[model samples]
Target: MATEHPAKARAPHRRPFQVATGVLGDLMFTTGVLLALLVAYSLWWTDVTVARHTGVAAEHLRQRWSAAAPAAPPTGTADTAVPPRFEADDGIGFLHVPAMGVGYQVLIKIGTGEDTLAEGVAGAYTNPYSSAMPWEPQGNFALAAHRDGHGAKFHDLDVLKPGDPLVVETRDRWYVYRVDATLPKTSKHDTGVIAPVPTGSPYTVPGRYITLTTCTPVYTSLYRMAVWGSLVREQPVDPDRTPPPELRKEDPSNG
Candidate 1:
């Protein structure tokens, strides 16, 4: 008689929990990938687009300046400087911050609106308080830009310290400001930071000051950061469009 063969062993069945855990892991991995892509798009892709827009804007400004006539005779007295008022669509000048980077520069537009700053340029505040132009004899020239993404124009603003140079380049003149104080964090509702005489700053009287404001803590808009500067001096832009020594000086922060 032929020997009976042992019954074939059955394969173990997988528990429902095991299958559920595997599915959960796969979903988590997919979600992680999507989140990373979102961050990259927000930070990298946006910067790339902004840079292109910024280049076009700068080139147009250069052409306009070249075709335009020199600045007209001063209409206001020395104590009350009155430069030309440009429309918000027309940029007023360029900002140079050596402390921020070796060749850190951004266009300066009139209004500090979302659309304005989204162009990867610096914007002058116009609401609640109008910003004083760099040519103004006395008042605060408040400005704003994105601290992260959208070109991150003022990403290194926190690096600026007392005596750091911040230069504004107009068609005919260069307005140089010196960092005197900083508010690392403050409520976003604090409009006083951009006032003619910014509160919480060293200034106790009216003066020609510059305030650079941006969102604080990076990647978040919960608070605001401000860097206050005083108009240290002014220099005439030569035919060659040479920058001031402040702009040329090497900044240790660049390292």
Candidate 2:
């Protein structure tokens, strides 16, 4: 019988292949994790930078207004008369509510320009085409602000309840408004809440009316949440004492 030649043992190259595959898999997973972390860091930095710039711009504007104010006449005197048109300032003059912590420098811009609300904060001007000015005696004085996690300017607006005080301070005067009702998102037919002073009426009231609008559902733009307040009082900014504005009757009676 011929002796069978011993089969040469094959070298264990399969072990090397398996080891290479494991290393590749681990590298791919590490790359994916690093990419995800970079993206998250970028978004966080962007938001914080924007907020800082907004605060700086607001402060600069306030300083300018303060300097100009002292040059003007004293409140309640014939020399110091409130203008029919409102002026938008850079810094917040007076805070409205201590509870809600809603404070910002009021701005009055005409015709809803592109840059009106571009600064990641509440626009100082009204959307001239959409609604009337909130401080105006006639028409719906509508105001808009961001409600998401971005700027969070009007985030606390929903917390407001009926009878909450809303304050507006200028260089010379302070306007006081009281929350009357809250309106949910609705169709045009649901004009009961937006109707002038009286419910279900087309006519506008002579007294000042304010409508604070922001995105509803907290952090989503699915709907609009509006808080309505009517002018309750007007107080002149006195050197020694400050008082709230008195409620006055709506003047125009019709839009």
Largest lDDT belongs to which candidate?
1
Per-residue lDDT over 139-234 for candidate 2, one digit per residue giving the tens place of the 0 to 100 score = 555556566443455777878788877776655666677777776564433334444453532235545676666667774667777778776766
The most accurate candidate by TM-score is 1
lDDT of 1 at 198: 96
Give each model a TM-score.
0.87, 0.60
Worst lDDT 10-window in candidate 1:
73-82
Q: After superposition, how far is residue 228 of candidate 1 from its true place, in Å?
A: 0.2
239 in model 1: Cα distance from truth in Å?
1.7
| Alpha-carbon shift of residue 29 in model 1 (angstroms) | 3.3
RMSD of 1: 4.1
Count steric clashes of candidate 1.
0
